[model samples]
Target: MMSTSFLHPCLRRMLSDRGGNFGIMTAIMAPVLLGAAGLAIDYSNMALSQRQLQESTDSAALAAATALASGKVADEAAAKTLAKDFVVGQMTNYAGTASASAIRNATNVDITTSTSSTSKSYSVTVATSYRLGLTPFMNLLGHSTIDISTTSSTTSGTSQTRSALSMELVLDQSGSMGYDTNTCAQYKKNGTTCKTYVVKIDALKQASASLFDALDKADPQHTLVRTGVISYSNGLLRDWTNKVTSVSAMDWGTTKSRDYVTTLSPDGGTDATEPMQLADDTIKKNANSTDAESVAHQKKGNSKVDRFIILMTDGEMTGNSNTWNKDKDQSVRDKCDAAKTDGITLFTVAFMAPDKGKSLLQYCASPGGNYYEAETMEKLVADFESIAQTATKAATLLTN
Candidate 1:
């Protein structure tokens, strides 16, 4: 205030005396220079606050959509509240400048839904604003504060759910599966003759185990996935002996194919007709059973379960005579066609099989199905793991 009263003297001194001009110019430009420097610093702070708001908004949208999609929160009102709470909670670091109530009041959460014949998807959009503090020199020009707003959105169908699955893994445990591959990595070992020689049986166990791991990762709670494994040799006989699939007996860890590959060498032939028939029928039976997993999925409003059959083999169908084997293979083909017609996706693997076995597996595989012919043990494992990843959409997880 006193400096304002002396402006005339300073101006008169600035013009009349060159010796005092530097001090006069400095006094004249000090406010402008400080305001410019403050603006530059405030710009950096504004960028950081905007980034925080955008990140919080993105996280809130994703959380809201996932909760809605996974049946955790069903209604629009609850989802919006969930989103608001999440946004306010995530931006606690920014609360040093703005109160939680201010952030909550500045945020707007909205949701929209899209439903087709089979699936429903929910999208959440979150828009939030943060008031950033400006420097005192800038504020003196009537620019007290600035408001920055950011918005983000996400959809729930692909983001949250893997689409419920009911899969029957029909695997071959015939004598030929006991033969060794070139490379040896031992899950089962001999005293010192070195390794157990990395047989096809061992490879099947590892591959099927990897498939289990993938499915588990995708559906950790076991609410959306129902998997059954059926191993066969010579007929409907599961020569591995310890496992069976039913509504009451669905334990993936206990009945895992990985733990049950020791009896393949003694099992004589590969007759997939009866086992293929059983696999297809089991899927239908479970879907219709009131006590089955479909009932539990229904309670969660995910009753539309997709069906899959993963058929694997090391040799073609065999029987009493060579001619009879062709008829048995025909029956297996019939089962494949019927299963596909019933909306069951079929993935087939021929593990170093001869031409006939490969041809059968290729034919059994649905159109647009994943069919693999793996010569090495590693390829076999990769193929099974790929099938599980593709089916469960494990590669594209978003907050699930």
Candidate 2:
């Protein structure tokens, strides 16, 4: 046992003092806390620089690759030069002139290009060492900067995986299509009495022609699209019966289809069942047949064939006195369901149609945005143009 009573008085007093202990501890830890803060700041700066570098590299790669894919750059040497230029330009935009210059001076950009029979590709790899803004703590730890690198690649060509389109246009030539409209008129002779009637069918013909024009413009070479026409009154017209034609077969320089449309006269009751059935039959035959034109246009291969039917009518479905014996509307609906089940997309247009007609078209169309109703002649044209654009746009497929 040690006795406190025997200790020296001055020594005991010093041991018992605890008033300045906190101040002493703070003084010892101050350097450590400050160093930690400095390291944190330096780490944040490094992270920001790394992100900037990554973004710049990615943008440069995309720009160069797009050019290569589009055939803007002829060969590998040109592509490499283009990629380097893009990187320098992008870095300059990301940082200031001084930083960009420093990065450019330190960086090495390598671009590799390869080509196959069907496609061209470009890959860009950017390597550089980034000089960090050093903190005193980081300097003490012997770390001033880090190296960052990134690689990106892109390819472009006519994709053999893309689907080709085969579209059938089934138009109504019902008596109602001859009704007066404010936008267009046609003259008809009845026993020397020439009557001028503003006709919906005339507007339909013009709009349909515009659609074909758009298709031609989208596919100038006539290699991607094929079309068939079936105009129906009481039944499919004998003149246009099974009149399916490919773009390659048609003379692109002439308006042969449009001219054929101009000769169509509106008569007889509207029966949509026959037209829908005919479209279904045509698409099915095109899909599986060994005929030369069918094999060239619609045959299954590495690519697929997209079958579509565009049904346009201005009146409700009426039972054909010559053919249909059951409920006409129900018969049409049944055929529509069968078409969809067979993977044939349907685009239904009702031009100034009654409620029954609109509802039927809506049901017949492929659900979710396939049905279009045009209240006027102008709208009919716009609808056809929109459909044409959609079909053409969907034909292009981009892959990475």
Candidate 3:
């Protein structure tokens, strides 16, 4: 009944009115949108500042811990002041003087220091709090400020044993030495290959002796060094035995100890796992006991002594032709893990291992434990020395 035309003024007016409403709505919301962007920028800046402060505080705490490890400070006040000063000084210089205001306003830093169970070590904790900058947009969103915090800790200890060392030198006497491989061609100075008389096993033995000599020379105190040897091929050539000849039953001092050697005659199958297990056992048993050396070193307040195992193998884990892979000898790994749980350090040395075997040897060490691969007698000798030094450093830091 009501007539309608294709173009109508009423319809056009309705469309125009909607567009006006949209414009009004956008005007009302524009500030809110801009404020949100500002808020995002503020939050990002706060996060970055928090991260920087945390890093600075962490470094400070570590430095303080090292200083405390010297055993020079006796009281808590001294320790705290030392830690705070170290942390503040480091952080202030971290970014130069120009950023001093930025650092101060961005974070609140604190450091706490405490002595170890033994009076020789110190533990430090660093904490930092960052106050968040409010974004203009965030104000409309109801957040005035945001706060972030982070904390970190570290420990340092001094060396109490003057000539402390735990060593296990393994010599390989496998038949591989009978036939000179292309690899052995280089060690020969003259036309004759060293393999002709001194086989691979003999070279290894010499290297082991050299390592002992180094240890003897490095010993500062005559009564402090302890040494062991494990030789393996088919079965364990040697058992878990301590120093063949201990110089003196003294503690905390090195003694002129006789060098010991355990040589394996190449003849049987190869089971590398057994030797490692046995060496680990020997170190654990000796460290726990009050031997002449331990008795001499006992003090009023000191942490429990630690043991170490240095295992070496020339080939992959193979013997009896039944198993060459390490997965089959998980029992050995379990034992090593148990020793580590008991606080024994484990190191592994591999000779002439392929890629796969090398990784296996490295894994034999506990996390962050020592793992070295040596192809020649010289490298093997060097590996032993390095392992000895690392163990000494760790022991000093832990016992001091």
- Report the lDDT of model 1 for residue 289: 48
Q: How displaced is residue 265 in candidate 2, in Å?
A: 1.1
> What is the per-residue lDDT of model 1 for residues 1-400, given as tens digits with 9 covering 90 to 100?
3458668888888788768678999999998898888889889989988888899999999989988888788688899999999888888766653578899998899899987634578889999998777888788567879999999999885344445777888888777787887656554455445455787887888888888888887766666777776777776553266444212223333244434443334256777777777777767534354746466557656646677889999888885333337877888899899888777889999998888889989999977758888999889989988998878873234443
Residue 76, candidate 3: C-alpha displacement in angstroms: 33
- Give model 1's clash tally: 0
Candidate 1 residues lying further than 4 Å off, grouped into runs, are 1-159, 185-196, 238-266, 285-293, 299-301, 320-324, 394-400
Give the best candidate by lDDT.
1
Candidate 3 to truth, TM: 0.47
List runs of model 2 lying over 4 Å from the truth: 1-161, 184-197, 239-256, 285-294, 298-302, 320-326
Q: Which runs of model 3 end up more than 4 angstroms from their true locations? A: 1-163, 177-198, 238-262, 285-304, 322-328, 395-400
Per-residue lDDT tens digits for candidate 2, residues 216-273, read 8866666666776778887665545665321112222225556667776788887878
Better of 2 and 3 by lDDT: 2
Error of 3 at 99 (Å): 41
List lDDT for all candidates, in order: 0.76, 0.72, 0.58
For residue 245, what is the lDDT in candidate 3?
A: 25
lDDT, candidate 3, at 153: 79
